[model samples]
Target chain A: MSKNQTVEQRYLPEIQRKEIDELKTTVKGASQKIIADNIARMKKADSHRPDTMKYFDDIANLFGRRQQEIEAEKQKGKKIIGYLCLFAPTELISAADAIPVRVNSGWYDTSKLGDRVVPVEVCPVIRSTIGAKMIELSPFLEQSDALISVLTCDGMTKLSEILSDQKTIWGMNVPRVKDSTQSLRFWSAEIKHMKTQIETFTGNKITRNSLKEAITTSHRATKAFRRLQELRKGNPVIMGQDAMLVNQAYSWDDKKRWTEKTEALCNELEKRVQQKDWVCSPDTPRVMLTGTPMFWPDSWKLPALVEEGNPKGIIVADEQCSGERILNDPIGVDEWSMDDMLNAISERYLMASTCPCFTSKDGNEDRINWLLNKVKEWNIQGVIYYVLRGCMLYAMEYNRVKKALDKINVPVYYLDTEYTREDVGQLKTRVEAFMELLNARIDF
Target chain B: MSTAKEFWRWHEYRHTMPNIAPVSDDIITAGVDVGSVGSKAAVMVNGQAYSWGITRTGSNSPESAKKALDLALKDTALSTRDLRYIVGTGYGRVNVPMANKAITEIACHARGANYIWGSSVRTVLDVGGQDIKAIKIDATGRVVSFLMNDKCAAGTGRGMEVFADLLQVPIEEIGAMSLKVEAEPEPVSCTCVAFAKTEAIGLLRKGWSKEKVLAAYTRAMAVRMANLINRVGLEPALVITGGQSKNVGIVSRIETLLGVKCLPTPNWRDGGLDPMVAGAFGAALLAKALYEKTQQI
Candidate 1:
């Protein structure tokens, strides 16, 4: 906060240091301080519940070690495909003998570079993605033989068009509406076309056996995450951010390794749950994060919120994506045929479409039902509808979420947010006040 | 909880205008709003406005809350104990010491604007230091819908301060001085405060007059705020409140842009209520309602 220190150094809020800087917007003093603080807090938090830390400590490598892993795979004669959206189906890319590295935009200086090419008004996620490519800051973007963009929202659609000029951008047209009976067949056809594109681009034949193995590996990771979600139901053994990191690990690292580490974490979490050892104060208020995709290492809001805020007894759970959306559903393929497996994948993804991207009459009802069930299941006290500043899809649905939560007599706090640390003070104040409101609402 | 206010006051800015001399102890309620840029406190006696104070918030929001109350209580025969209930609102609401309840500034601003501007006022635009809020309200002064620009200061008072410092014009003179420009210049077109500051310097370096630069910045503020206002679908009988209402440059440009005249905001100098204390005033009103509800129980 001194005169000489940069604005980021002065403004960056209290974040633990040991964890990866997910947003990767590095501040000098706060970054170092957070590193030290994160180590101490994670230790202190994990001390009482030894079962939780066992897997978390080991799996920490999944964050910063992405580029190195991609490089190692490239040296192993494997092609890498950097994908933007979850709908891209990494399993298919891997089936074609290409390593699917999930690429996200969060590097700080990339935005300045991006401003020259794209209007500054576009979403920061897209800005940073294009910026990363322009500056060659993203290892995944650099390493990938091709990039896949899932037409999830307006931003991704525009991003795909712009990025196609530089890279082999495959724009996968996933239908926006989810309710039509033919949409499954529609999406299944799209995925089948995507497989052909990958096979053609990588010049690798995607055999039926390879596809099955990839689905099984993906199922294991999500199944482990499902177990982790079950652990979140009672006594909250795993802090929400740590659980989110578990979900994020699926996209960044080797799938088999991610599943193994997550399963190990889940095993510890199971023990802690049985022992009734809770890291958070029993008074902790459970809050479900319902909003847009909060990309890893590029999105630090979750970690920042949970580090100090969770300690204040506010536990964040059930993120819209990169948290629950990635982990909630499984790809079905009991018969193991190519067509059958593709159908199952489409069906599971349809079931996992909790995002408002597939807006329909049932959108609010379906989402509200899921939220209501989760609130009751996890004993949630409130819901935090966190949105990226320009992410209108999630921001647009706040009223429906609030209306539903209101009926259930639960409070919902709508947070329009961004990646910068400048407004950390303001966010903290609002969150603390919300905590006070939730506490006061509790019936004694 | 902490008595750190004793020494910190020397470094902080504090002010109170048109102080009230408390005569009755009947149903006295207080509200403190510790905002990012400034803090305000209002004391209401017998469901009526009494006195209020404004101060620049330091790190200790609790002290800012207490100091705000202290200044409001100054020149009046009143103390903290005299207030029956204390309600805290705004960004640092939870940090306020001795607050019976905490509420959001959006709700408070709507209710306060309704009370000041009249029950017929359906829209409330609150431009605070670091953020801007546009609220739609019903006849009961209950919030129908609200849009708040999160974590950006480009169109708010904080942005105004940046332009003020760059042009060597006092914050108070930004509005009037901007209007004096012979011909209006195109507004700076960046939403980022930091980016817009650079854009502003570029204009000045091009030999644009200080008035011209101020004119551009003011139009930009109005343009930025107009988008936020259009979000909730502006209703007639619109009113502006909070610290930014004092800036005529932004307000008049906004009026021109909206093509609808703004409902006159409160001005203490004109013997009207201070519009800046809307959040705190509304908090006090809510405290009275809560106090009454408890009394019935």
Candidate 2:
């Protein structure tokens, strides 16, 4: 096989090649439609949406203008590094002078194509990621020189192996036991190894100075994100779905630009707060959404329904990895030394994570505490805990989180769903019922 | 040549008390619940259920809502315009053009169950046309926690109707017929209605009687409902509501499975309100509260 040959050209015959060509068109069209429809819904999501939101919304339009921007960046001789899980440190990818793009997709049509490679019961995130890669439809996946595959779950681990057939893969072994000295040391070594692999792949040595700059870049974004969280506390000026879109854009946007735009959005929200221009009435139910990460297109459903009631309930905050958790949990770097920075990054990514991948002695006390704090801070009346079907780790942790919320008298509605739109009606009823419960409680 | 004509059809009816004359100043409220398989409307006067009607939901939801409300208002001096407030519920709640407010059937059922059986009811299991819900409510009929069946049509009124049609038994007779079996048979598949139907066909091939097949299905539905009920947990004075509560086979089996008898559904002041009208009745009760709140404001 030639180095420059495509997967289809090498593996498929002429007839199958033509079939794939037609299928690729369908996949591309459907993916764009999903992105466009979601963006339109998001723009009209609130009547008082800040003008700064358009920037983040455009970046979330996966196959749109963002692709041209990525192509231009590639033309400038910068390597694009695609990643899936948050465990893959984005700062390290930036340190190697490579642009990091989170390539996890939430489109249903592309996930169907993945059935050919993986079983149907595998996680939709894994399926869509691999499915987009197989058809070469995702511009981010196509442009990425290498994918940083973090071993977070069995599905992701297997996904890396399947992706390795067509792409350059750098696999990271995340320690499942998050709260121990031994695991910390093990993770630090793994990060160091990843640093070396990324440096070699980009042919750029990650000096201590470049690594510090990268850490500072993410820290600036985190600063802006923390400010946004502060604004969301008292009265929700921004809806959860819009805030999640901002966080999601951080995965694909240029770090400095994302920080600037987020800071601007936060500024608008601050103004709205002073003007008392709340997105929803004060009596509306303040819901805190947690559980599995919701990516673009598919992320719109639950959050949209959350706010689409007579009084229109508001998602005051969310603890999802794709929402508030992005650019959060910043690294606490004491020394500017390479080893210390690497150790801090490893610790921040591993120990501070509430992602259900790690098993702590207290059974997700960290996640529960994080959720409870959010609930209290926002005065959230309810919690909508939705798990994407086949994402078992989040589903498994629901009962524990529900039990914790029960102690605080906050109601949690557990919804199990996939990427399809088939169950929207059913989900709407449940979500509305939950909103009704919260509203009635507020009336008393 | 099977000549049995639509064994699953259930008659629709409207009833109102002739003794209580219509008072113009009284607070009038209506609740229209347009479910997937059936539609119901309950009219309440000053928080009391005055009249109610049940009908099969047609293709057009707004029409169904109108038809149900018209039936409930039939032979009554009060017209639809006289109602102070109307609350719509169930799956087609949003489509009710005349409703001033639309509340979910979950909240409505808990409220209706409280009104029907009193505030002692803590857990309410409502088996409706397309789904089942196990709701845990407080003394004030406020929903504390509730669980609805997933996006499946098993263990619901619709599933029971399918069984009735398959067995060539009238829908109303299914409960009594299922009880006629001398010994309890093994339940059918408790997973899916489609799979259970296939299993029932297999049982019939094995020469099992229709009564035994009906028993097996009802038992399976009861087991599924019991699982959901246990998941929500059984508090004291559990009340069963909705269309499936009319079927004693499922209700009795669920009682035996949970080892707790459900509270009886008495004829609401001899108005002959069927258990199927719980959602509508509950909505009517809520409408009365809303009307009163507005009046005070």
Candidate 3:
């Protein structure tokens, strides 16, 4: 061992560390290119995109202007708390006077670096997130003072353990059964524990007023998100990818600014609806995407393929954790007391979530019910169930979702994929075939 | 046929009917299917199959599409301008230069099977060059649901070709020769084609007969196909299409595994169409319907 080496430093050699640093430089350029290409495609997708979408494009640019803003925040001695899953209560982070950033990495190249630490069979999201930390690639992940790791699924739990060695890690155990009253009490206690952890990490006392104000910030964003969802229902003036970008920016951009920008986008869409300017024809097959969450550049491929051809399909809505469901359900509080507010936050993040991670008494009936209601509300003609490879929860739940959709005569196409670009040709053929079946129904 | 040293080659050919019927007021449409390994062009006169040509796909898809169409219309009076509409199908469908619209091969195969075997055919198992698709359809030939083999290339025409090259047997003759084995051997037992190829090489080194090796390979292919067919929830009467359908070794094995006889695809010598051209044929049929719809408007 070297003279200054510790136990942790010995496991990872200096030579391997130097190699990873070199790889990090190349991955940064490739990741920026992926973001730029996707943003270019989004802008040129349809002529009806609102001008306010530029705000989302800028924030989602990865190492662009938002990265600079984050660096500036770091310079001002503000702590950045990175959260892995949606179960990490951002309200507490903001209340503790720290910036909350969701650090789920979607870049495919970064996953290769993560392969050194984790096995190849793990899901790409976990690998990419770990790899991003290993190389210090993502600005959001690099700037974080601590990471809030929610043990939502099996892959995520292991991911937290691997990441804890690099950063000060705080853990949250999500109860599996959402319908039980006992689970809520357990989760409320966990949330209280988390508040104290964040307070100690950031060295800021989270008062009742601070929590109240943070909840208000999220409520404004949720109200704008609901408005955007309502605008997508009757007529699709905004493309699905654009709407997803606005939501994805919630994880990066300042929440209050995201709220104002989304509201402005909704106002622009309202005017388009009045003028009868639609992105696609009235009869194009409206499809809903469900299953595992897809973030940023990785999510753009499917939406682009869906909206590609003449008389193309439009992604009218999605039930993914990364999409419309990101913040659509606002937390309701009867009183502003600390205990009542924590109880409300716990219930909202845990109980109301239809994530596949939670298995109630019945098998996936909650998620199925949510999907069916959204399908009817959006006039969805087809459903695309996307499962990222190695994500066992979503992959295993495909049949239950399919069986439920089958009962209503709404066809579901099961798409199993990874974060790689090699499968684009295969995915295109399957998606086009599904579109053909939907079109045949319309014509015949 | 192979010489003492050189490998036997799969020949490429094209044919059209010697006689043509007098021109009528029927609308003519065509389809071009540019696949990963093969390209086919089919011409339909008044929603009836007129002629088709199949050729090996080259490095350039648009050129291959043109060559296939040229062969289909070799001695015919109909030209590209004569057809009211042209639709493209298969993996390289969008690369067809003259295609008016691109339809997916899944839809095309179901519709083509319906036309080839009549409306009674409700399930189709199309084993293509690089993919295997099991499609379930309604009585009217519209696709109800379908499943295709992912990323892996086992149980496809390409997989069969690998065996043919390894055994030094002609691709067509491998099927009949494989059926002559005393009894079916256990399948290659590898779900991946690369691993199966290695296993086949290992079996050959152990002095297994060529016919027995062929039997084992085809059986493995059949099992892989059957798994996909079961997943798609097969309905009868079933029909098989694509180049692999001509392989009796794979076909009989699949029939036995599924316990259902696939309806016959009439031989070309018997004045019937080639099974490989099914995707193009279906696209042609859909092109006619699309043309009629436009005319109505």
Candidate 4:
């Protein structure tokens, strides 16, 4: 424990402690393994899952205790602010003397009760989030003093409306138009409002020096994350979805500490690459994944992508929303007054972020170009465009993305998925077919 | 186990039986489809289906595949070694240890359906035990685009199997019985097979006749399949393949919904080929292609 952290704050909230003791629900399903298969051609890790990382089971099983841990952080005089989208920069919240914890629910069964309060057709993540918080099933509601939501889509905007009655929420106006001067200015204004909210809630003046320090801390994490990303290009040294976990942990863990751990992991990964230690054979089909934010137990795509059912192993590259999204852009904070700092943060998130919701024709075309470049650069022969069930914006952009990838004769598989095991068989068939095409083209 | 109690178990619908014989010619290339519902093996020689066998898939996919292949080669007096090339497909395609190559059932279905229905068939809708696929094919029977339902079982063959068992109707009789109803009750409105089962029981308890209940479930399956088919954009030449293609109840309802009958023949050839064999037939064709390519090299 950190010197400033107290024992009381770290203890599990009474209700969760009792539930965890009785059920062990969070601890028991602690391991999710993605078999790299017994194919003779690959050198990748035999399995990638909770056991792949150090303290993986401990971290994965730590879900039920999260609220108390964050609460404990709060007792150490840190303000806990929950965020929903990548569009809302955690750096800004950190600059304001608050810890930004992304509030995504991982318990698939627990999210079922969430649907009583939401429409059945709403996105599973949204329904689950609403259910978890409304039912007091999630530690997020218990730990968070405030919420920062980027109004990226209807589900999130409405989620903010529903959640605002429970706690303070500052909705960031995520503009649809990317790279526009007006949109950038508008987003910057929203960040300014967010600054005021943080000030009022925390009762601490965020000085220029403190904000600049936060930016520096954030940049360190980005550098480490970027390093991991570089290690993942083409033939990945890191097997399976372990790289995804490193990125996912960034969403919840303290960025500086997560950076150190990731950096350390990168060093280990660097050695593996040098030693020619790989999880999959060089012949494994390389796939570029996009669509849907997969976090924690919200994991379906990663396992399906690289699992044994596809015969020869498949290597998954870090994708738009989950992998490179958080680490790719850093706020350039030279002389960090509130205005300059907020503008930098806004620029990093709204302008630089390549989310499809920020769709201007030129912006979308650039995203396609970026995807095409990623395909060739990463040796990705196939693309899996996975859309979360009821995710409209991402699903809508499929045709545009597909056309560009198609131009290069790259095989693309579009999957509309939910967090359920029932359809895994179907998904496997589609992916296997895609793999067949990709593998056949390998010789060509 | 009786199909009723086993309705909840997807593999219980597993069937492994074959009404098969041999062509007694050079048809030796093999295609195996080890699916969640069933396993099939087709042996092709001289560009014609020689002998094929169907069997219920067991827990071990490779074993089921081998069993089907053994049965397929029985009349021909051959073994896996005798076949020039073998292509495995369906959900268990990867599990076929003896296959030279594993193809996606989507591609296999497209290739197989093209041969059965003919080249003009542009759209292929295949509802397997646990999946529903709408595949758009080019003139050459290559998959141009495809869409699949990856949620709960509603429009799939699994749902029909459950309804068949729930009503205590033999799986074969349910289709005919569904049409025998005097009037169609409102089709069960749920998109989940489990929920539709509950709805089936509720309707049965409400004194709805067995035929009527079957009719309701069948109609619901049609509506669901139509929605999926519409999403992929149905072309003029549409055909239904896979296990569910045999269900006259769902097929008739789908025809009514589209107001056009599904192809009576596989294609313009006016030759009748069993729909279930389409995936295996396609695999055989691909195996043949690969074998010829290898020989040329």
Q: Quote each prediction's TM-score.
A: 0.69, 0.96, 0.97, 0.77
Residues A222-293 of candidate 4 have per-residue lDDT tens digits of 898778778878465765456666677677776777888778877877777888877768777777778877
DockQ scores of all models, one per candidate: 0.14, 0.78, 0.75, 0.41
Local distance difference test, each candidate: 0.74, 0.86, 0.86, 0.73
Candidate 3 or 1, higher lDDT: 3
Q: Model 1: clashing residue pairs? A: A16-A38, A17-A34, A17-A35, A17-A38, A22-A297, A22-A298, A23-A297, A23-A298
Worst 10 residues of 1 chain A by lDDT: A6-15
Q: Residue-wise lDDT of candidate 1 within B37-145, one digit each (tens)? A: 7899988886678878888887888998888889878867678888988888888887887899877787677778877777899988999988888877877677666
Candidates in descending TM-score order: 3, 2, 4, 1
Each model's fnat? 0.17, 0.78, 0.74, 0.48
In candidate 3, stretches whose alpha carbon ends up further than 4 angstroms from where it belongs are A1-17, A362-364, B1-8, B17-24
Query: In model 1, how large is the Cα lDDT of residue B49?
Result: 80
- Highest TM-score: which candidate? 3
Instruction: State the displacement of the C-alpha of residue A259, model 3, in Å, after optimal TM-score superposition.
Output: 0.4
Q: Tens digits of per-residue lDDT for model 4 on B27-46?
A: 46888998888788887775
Chain B TM, per prediction: 0.92, 0.96, 0.95, 0.88
Q: Write the per-residue lDDT of candidate 3 for residues A114-161, one digit (tens) a residue.
A: 787778889989888877777888888888889988899998898888
Candidate 4 recovers what fraction of true contacts?
0.48
